[model samples]
Target: MWKVVVVALAGLVLAGVGGVALAYPSLAATTCPGCYGLTELSPGVHVEDGLSPAQRERVGEVADQAARRVTAFYGGRRSSPGLLVCLTEACYRRIGGGQERGVAVLNRSVMLSPRGLDPVIASHEMSHVELHARLASSAEVPQWFDEGLAVVVSGDPRYLAPESAPDRCLVAPSGPLPVTLEEWLRTASADPATYARSACQVSRWLGENGGRAGLLGLVTRLNAGEPFSALVRTR
Candidate 1:
């Protein structure tokens, strides 16, 4: 009877592991990138199997450009995170991608779906990585500011006017901007234009402050143990 009970417990543990792997395959991929048959197209860029030489070249070029843009905006450089690119829907889903084109996995890596191959999308995700590297914890900043800063840095024309002032509101939000990640996700799903609204508000705030300098200052203060609320009182 004791032997049977031990076997049952082992089976339960295996089942739980399988469940988690299915729910979040990205965790497995990050843990062992080569397990998914990903090949390094460059120093830090990994591509799913079956990607052609031209496709690999494109990914490398786009990632390089994105990194440069982010570095320029931040006025400093952070270590490049692993970039995982999936060229097919199956690969994307296998690596835990959903409706989103791209996602930043903390400050460690960025995963890109087939549709997220553009420079703007890559830069947007990398912006998240940059901010995460700077902060002791991502929780230090609000969700709106996080996404908004990405939009601004990526120069996402969808949310902001080209060559226009960043403070100008383009698309009105459906409601109040979300402060937390959960609320931001819910509001974003309900109204896709929440990104524009966030960008608008952050842009306005940056304008009132010192622009990129203000952002760096704010981050410095946050790192030095200053409250985000007191630093970003304009918001």
Candidate 2:
């Protein structure tokens, strides 16, 4: 029953991830009983588990596997300084990763638990990290685009639903999807079904177009600071 969700910097905006609080407690304001620095397991993959050395190793193995999956997903097109996967309650709370965001990727790192670490979750956050690496700014990316692409690239099962059309690549649980991407971001996350809908729509878009090639072109344009509206016309 523990389906994974990834909260991208958009806090699900990027990976269809959602729900925890927005504020991050100062690092100094919080500390784990057995605080430890993140350990580098594989290239650009890090893990910090306060439980035991054996647990740390286990988490590291999972992270390494996820990292490889992510790299392969993009066909080795992207990377970052590193990725941090933590398994400390204190760290989770401080970073805002609870039921709302069990697996989230923030500006500083990616937060995860052994219970939450899966290929889908890991790859979703990895997509966000790589996108940010490309965008490289506070440059806004539409929530639907972010979350949808994460779900698509992560190969999450929820995205298997075959939506009808590429033009239909938009959703809102209520009141008609807002007029603007910004407005959609403000409203879409409120609905619990947001992630699944987004994944379906995005998958449809990728399929209707030219698969990864089309996706990469769109990503490149977005990184160049193109607006999401330019790619998908919504009236």
Candidate 3:
């Protein structure tokens, strides 16, 4: 069985499987072979593919719904217009499968397994793509923040709890508040509970503080090299 290999970055960790060495650029480049969308999102990221016509339509529906949610959440920001959706098992395998899903922001893409997710759940994964693109590429939003927002945006309340937290989100407490970003990335994996709580907190904070507009500001601040400590402090 293939295992997960996680790559860490500015407090975010992406899960990959096997020694397959799926180059990020190649995997990111896996658009519809010959088709690429030329919009603000440019070369819209491929989600999953290799499905029957019905499945393809379903994937497209899921993608469209997710796009709406992202736009609603960050209407003020410039988001990629479309997301290439795929649903074939083979397509999942080509990218990797140990992890439930993967999102590549550089190429403005997202990939997921549609085995058991409902449209809402799949939309959640799509939200991750939007978040990845909207947030400052260099911001230290923290893994919990990233995964948490994805879950919250999906509209699933379960993700607000630790036990129900996503597999990749990890967190630990060094003192009293919660595990710092440094601790989260340094740890082997995030603690499920801490991650959930942090995500919920951030989501609520963004909503109450400035709604989507505030969230955009936070992401912009992070991308501009503002201290996460200052930005996240509101949360």
For every model shown, what is its TM-score relative to the native structure? 0.87, 0.65, 0.62
**Candidate 3 lDDT score relative to the true structure:** 0.52
Looking at candidate 2, what is the lDDT of residue 222? 73
Q: Write the per-residue lDDT of candidate 3 for residues 119-151, one digit (tens) a residue.
A: 555556566666766665576666656666766
Error of 2 at 68 (Å): 2.6
Candidate 2 C-alpha error for residue 197, in Å: 1.2
Candidate 2 residue lDDT tens string, 1-235: 2244432344456333122122433231122212335556666665663447776676666666766766775677456534455666655565445653334445334666545666667767767777666664745666666776777667666544433443433442232344455765566567645665666566666667787677778767876788777786432
Q: How far off is model 2, as Cα RMSD?
A: 12.3
Q: For candidate 1, write residues 1-235 as lDDT tens digits.
A: 9999999999999898788678778876766678787888888888998878898889988899999889989998775789999989899888888989999985679999999998899999999989888887643988998998999889899998764663466875545678899999998999879999998878778888888899988888898888887877533
- Which candidate number has the best lDDT? 1
User: What local lDDT score does residue 79 receive in model 2, on the 0 to 100 scale?
Assistant: 61
TM-score of 2: 0.65
Worst 10 residues of 2 by lDDT: 25-34
**Number of the predicted model whose TM-score against the real structure is largest:** 1
What ranges in model 1 sit over 4 Å off?
A: 1-20, 165-168, 172-175
Model 3 alpha-carbon miss at residue 203, Å: 2.8
